[model samples]
Target: MQNLFYALTFERTLDRYSQADTTEVDVTAKVDPAGRTAQLLSAFFGLDEGLPRIADWAVCDGAGGKDGMPVIFSHEVGLNTLEPGDFAIKRRSGKLGEVTCLTLAPADDPGELRTVLLAGQFGSESDPPVSVEITGDIISLDQSVTFKGAQVAVTPLEDGPSLVLAEKVPQGQWELGKAATGIPFGGGSGCPEGTAQVLRVTWEGGITKPDGNAADDQERKLYRVTIRQEDGSEETIAPMHLADTGDGDNNHKLCLDRTEPVKSIAFPAGGFTDPRGDLNPPTYIGVSQRLIDKQS
Candidate 1:
């Protein structure tokens, strides 16, 4: 038998339709039992604490006869359903391994006015297997959860569009060299010591024929960056060639290859050679010194 220790808290307020109801609750419990399900259920309902532990619920191993397994217990505590004992459990497949620990935290949401975050670990003592988050927009594993190795993020574009970016550890410098005067390697004096970083950017363009169906092909674009140091010295790196991150919307990798601390970045308009051997139109995308400084 193992010991199960948990702390839970609940808070909610409702003021609408001539009704005002509010609840604030906090509970902490420690249970020693043979099964996690019983312990969780007992803690959730605040059942007899000192009673002898019981292992009534069967734990499934995702094999024969007990394939579809659910969390032993789950509770949704929203404005309409607010109580001290309400709690939630972030579940994972036991097939992965034995679950070690779990925790739930309330997250911030401007639209929903209520949100919960759940985190859990499996197998190892430290690595997190599942991360839960509730956002104003939507809840999803790719968008709201953090897993090992890689993570994906969504950034709202200035033009009212949304761009999804995946987190990647910037490894070796993809583009090495200096800043140039213009796109196509023509014009502007080159900065010999500069390096360039790469970032994957994905976007979808809706180009439809008169029939209103999306064109079969929509391509992604890549941009190379150059930075100027605070000391007025500029380092130039070769342009990076980003590849698809596979999420579909024109995903590309972003890399920064630099030699010195950056103070400013030059935003010039010129065409870049697309990986497909096509020339991309020129636009001004500036890199801020703050972004460069973040590298150090």
Candidate 2:
């Protein structure tokens, strides 16, 4: 029975497993014959791991009326994982700056925990930051993997909102697209035009019209897609007109006209606009799901 219980616990943790994982196991024993009460006992066990990686970084309003930037991690980090000297910044002019303080972007947004807002002189518009490095050990919340020397190039602030994530939607992911209506995928048969592919994209920030309203369906062309075909040919195309099935207001699905297999899909910047009417500069997202950042 003890072995079976241990096996169940291991299975439950399988999804979070990585390399050389270890965990502390606890045991509880029944105190009464009817098993109404329980007693705690110390125990042991182990298993997966993954290091924290930078997912996105952006410049925000600073504390001293300067810039307080946010660095988002791919994995959730421990609350106490921050330190002043853990990070190093490199700029286009080859100057360096040290982060003075760090905090969650804001306490209001519970979802912003993955982001660490920093205050320092990383770079300026004239001399943009080229990259960021993790010089000290950073630990993840789940597997507690240590992160160090993890460097990622900085996205130019002039390049408007970039992709936070993108992926191919699985079949039947959303019921909205099952039957084509006004902008739906279906044609006469309501079977979604017989041949269509869907690509889902999530931006770093919410997108809205110049008047700060939600964008129209046709506005998806803002981030135009260019795909390479299997036969070694490339064509630039916009997503087919479809109802917005984006997650929250920052994500959206792009329907593609289909005939041949596609090798890749990428988009240049400057097409998208923020609710505040900020224009996107340039950023590219491909089939491999390379993450991009934003400047707010």
Candidate 3:
């Protein structure tokens, strides 16, 4: 079915003089029982709301909660964590059968976690690759191609350095410019007749930093993508390493821009590999038609 996850971003006050530190907790799994209680205060708060520690809590509705109100729960008993007891959990308003499907874990920093729900539950560790025909890769302000597929199989770590995404803006050309001002910034109305928006898809994997510190110890991976157009033409997007210094600040190189429209994109079998020389089966995430709808 579908998988739902919750992202809880909050700040915790450790001591009087020390600075308040921020952390995130991911409730990826669903609680059991139709009317069970899902106590969240323990992991996030040590006391009551008067302390006011929570920043924001977001619920990402997955497969089962689309029709009904997003999976809701109630709190039972006091929220004091000093007392010993498991947090009571109950599924309030949703389908009870598959409500508790996902298994979750605690995340300190949520920036590194990039999750994509596998559409139609298609990809398996053992499925053969499929070839599809695509026309041309086109990017536009209104509608564009984007990715939506599997969860980021690679875990993110602060020490595990990875290449950042960069955009290229030529002189007299803006990355997200408006038609009137001729400036390369967002929030412009109307696009030029000839030019299109450029949308690039890059694979981010784990890598070791020069300082000999790899946080998660997950090695970096490299994979080349192949674009299949409707006209039966094939083009390959070269794989680049993490930019040395210039990421997005300096217009290093344009990987994908609003140039042409693409029919279908595909990844070859046995394309993914890590630094240690391990490979993964062919799998693809969903590419959105409007990835750059709005920066805000």
Candidate 4:
């Protein structure tokens, strides 16, 4: 016989402007019976978007269980608090049925975040009545019911430089020279006028096979480049393939002009292979172009 279970996934971001704190929270709950899966839903009232903006949220099921008989709720919250293994929770009881809650916390060593689990039921005979555990800060639930909402705190990071456009460039592929300009420089003081910058590129994007022939698609590959500045800051630039130029003989090269400064440059080979047939396709290449300046 098939049974029905209710599931709800909750996610929220917490932003504290005064303390510059931000965090992400993820909550998941599901009921399963026998071997079938059930639909999860969230019932929100009023016009508010539930909780305030947070860093992130995630949810999952407990270990070992099926559709409805044994349901589990797991929640993961990411924050910047020094005490990562601590949390505060407030819950409202469901109209009918049973409810369970569990709480899990991370260790004090500063690696994993804590967790909490809460489990309960409207009518059931179990030892310890409503049980709660505190391991660092992770919670686990065994019985089942439902929860209304949750809240947490987090930390925020100021505007910072990051690595973007770190993908492989397809081979036999060419991009326009004009497209090479406009690479974003890491946010910092400008570099000297005449310095040689270096960029190290790597392959990351996926490849596909259009024709059944393994050799034809294998011949197509990608390239990339990386840029490094004098201040130890760096950026990467990779040529994006516009379209196939037929066969693969008419390969194009996107070059940086001499007028442009060479801050950094690095190129890596692409790695791609075909699975359906017995052919190892060409690797993708990434090129990192650095802006170089002429010595005064």
Candidate 5:
């Protein structure tokens, strides 16, 4: 009985995705009406043309104390239509806070506009922020897709850099398409040879590992990744290289060595240093290969 519904759902989904209806998926969940998986898949099948999504929310800290939250988007945002009031947040205590200020972090570089530091009267240590929501009309610079009323979880202020995303592609391009059907980078060449997976290590605030005097000159290595071989042996490795999308967004694209199946990734203290000369604290991430956002 369950298979029947899904069988029908899959057929409609493929048909819907192939045609002009780019709004939402038209799948029937009446067979498993109470099934949360069916409901969720229905929502995902019908996306808003893969508009700018809430990528990350990190609490921004400084000498002024923990008074800011940095919001990262999936795509480049149009700054001409941006405002602090376009966003809101929900504190851990369930208190809603309004964003009173917004600015591009590391304002020196106008090229990188993905990280916007949102300022407001967020809760104190007793009730720090937990989530952020979009409230106003904001468009992506890449495709002019307006993403509103969407929310995502946030990282705390005291935390250091961590591995947040796993993708098949290194850049901001989506797995199958680019930026949810907008535009893809590169000349249509696919992933590099002998590559298995791509891990995106990101920090809450902004960071840089400068090779030379230039801001884009990057120092990529920052992780000690352990892989479990088919023979049950574990081999640890270093980040071979970093992803260069021509901007700083606290992302370290560590390309994996073949499909050996990763067991864990260990980030050492001082492995990464932010623009402010602060070291990234040590953190170990347990990766479940079964589930990952495979967007290359």
Candidate 6:
């Protein structure tokens, strides 16, 4: 058994003169009982000072079903029609939740403005429940709904080794180093023969405009190295280069083997520079590179 509570208030004008001279009266009531419906009653009689008399009243009920489900039922005692009004509800579901809004309109003239109510399970299964109404004016609802979609496909690219330079190098001098070593070519076991590799290098920093040449401020230089496989096809090696100014000393060098195939590489502006020390010119460098697969 579920208990219900109700409160109500109403206002009425007995006459034009009385209404013009007096303020509307307010009334409220609450009902608690084990029932599907509740009732409210009130009355007013003339006593002393007969200027004008009026009666106002209202009754509201709070209740729920056995399953704890939520429902809304509206009853009109004397009103046969209704105008416009807004309504909304929030509900939760397994791993999902939603809010719904619905609108109700008067059927036809002469026909009683019947109360319209919606009841349903909320969340992911279907559209959320909603309700709405408008009197003689227009009404609208703002809605934003979203749902998850399926995952799409992603193709895999061939795995080619990349080349990363060592972080620290011997002070004053530059040393060439390799991050990813190359595999021997074709034998049905490793890299195919005639498979060539290429490395494209771009110089970024380090003694820019050595003599203040026209390319002094360019801040970028490009170079390429390629290795051919026994099969005649080629696998390009990653490119290398220097970064822009501001990256320490910017004097750096990159080394690649005849077997290593370049995959992907990038030399962001100012990527390399000399290690922190008191050295004047600062021993550091920046460079960029790219490797492409060549068709046989």
The TM-score leader among the candidates is: 5
Q: Estimate each model's TM-score.
A: 0.24, 0.45, 0.25, 0.17, 0.47, 0.15
* Model 2 deviation from the true structure expressed as Cα RMSD, one decimal place: 17.4
lDDT of 1 by residue, 28-132 (tens): 222112111112111110001111121111111111121111111111123332211222212233233222211111111111112121111221223222322
- What tens-digit string does per-residue lDDT give for candidate 2 at 103-146? 44321121223445455556666776677766655555443354
Q: How many clashing residue pairs appear in each of the predictions shown?
A: 26, 7, 36, 102, 4, 60
On residues 14-115, what C-alpha lDDT tens digit does candidate 5 reach at each position? 000011113232322222212212100000000111111221221122112225455666444566556666666778889986444455533212223455
Cα RMSDs, all models: 22.0, 17.4, 18.7, 22.5, 15.1, 34.8
Models ranked on TM-score: 5, 2, 3, 1, 4, 6
lDDT of 4 by residue, 150-220 (tens): 22211001111111112122211222222211111101111122322212121111122335321121232
Identify the leading candidate in terms of lDDT: 5
User: Which regions in candidate 2 have their CA more than 4 angstroms from the true location?
Assistant: 1-64, 68-85, 91-120, 125-128, 139-147, 161-165, 169-214, 223-263, 274-278, 289-296
Identify the runs in model 6 with alpha carbons over 4 angstroms from their true place.
Answer: 1-27, 30-74, 77-88, 94-103, 108-111, 117-123, 126-296
* Runs with alpha carbons beyond 4 Å of true place in candidate 1: 1-198, 202-222, 233-240, 245-247, 255-282, 286-296
Q: Judged by lDDT relative to the true structure, which candidate is superior, 3 or 5?
A: 5
The global Cα lDDT (0 to 1) of model 5 is 0.45
Whole-model Cα lDDT of every candidate shown, in order: 0.23, 0.44, 0.22, 0.21, 0.45, 0.20
Ranking by lDDT: 5, 2, 1, 3, 4, 6
Candidate 3 wrong stretches, greater than 4 Å? 1-254, 263-277
**Model 4 C-alpha RMSD to native:** 22.5
The C-alpha stretches of model 5 lying farther than 4 A from their native spots are 1-68, 72-86, 90-96, 100-158, 170-197, 209-221, 274-278, 287-296
Error of 3 at 287 (Å): 2.1
In model 2, which residue pairs have backbone atoms overlapping below 3 Å? 18-48, 18-49, 21-47, 21-48, 62-68, 160-281, 186-192
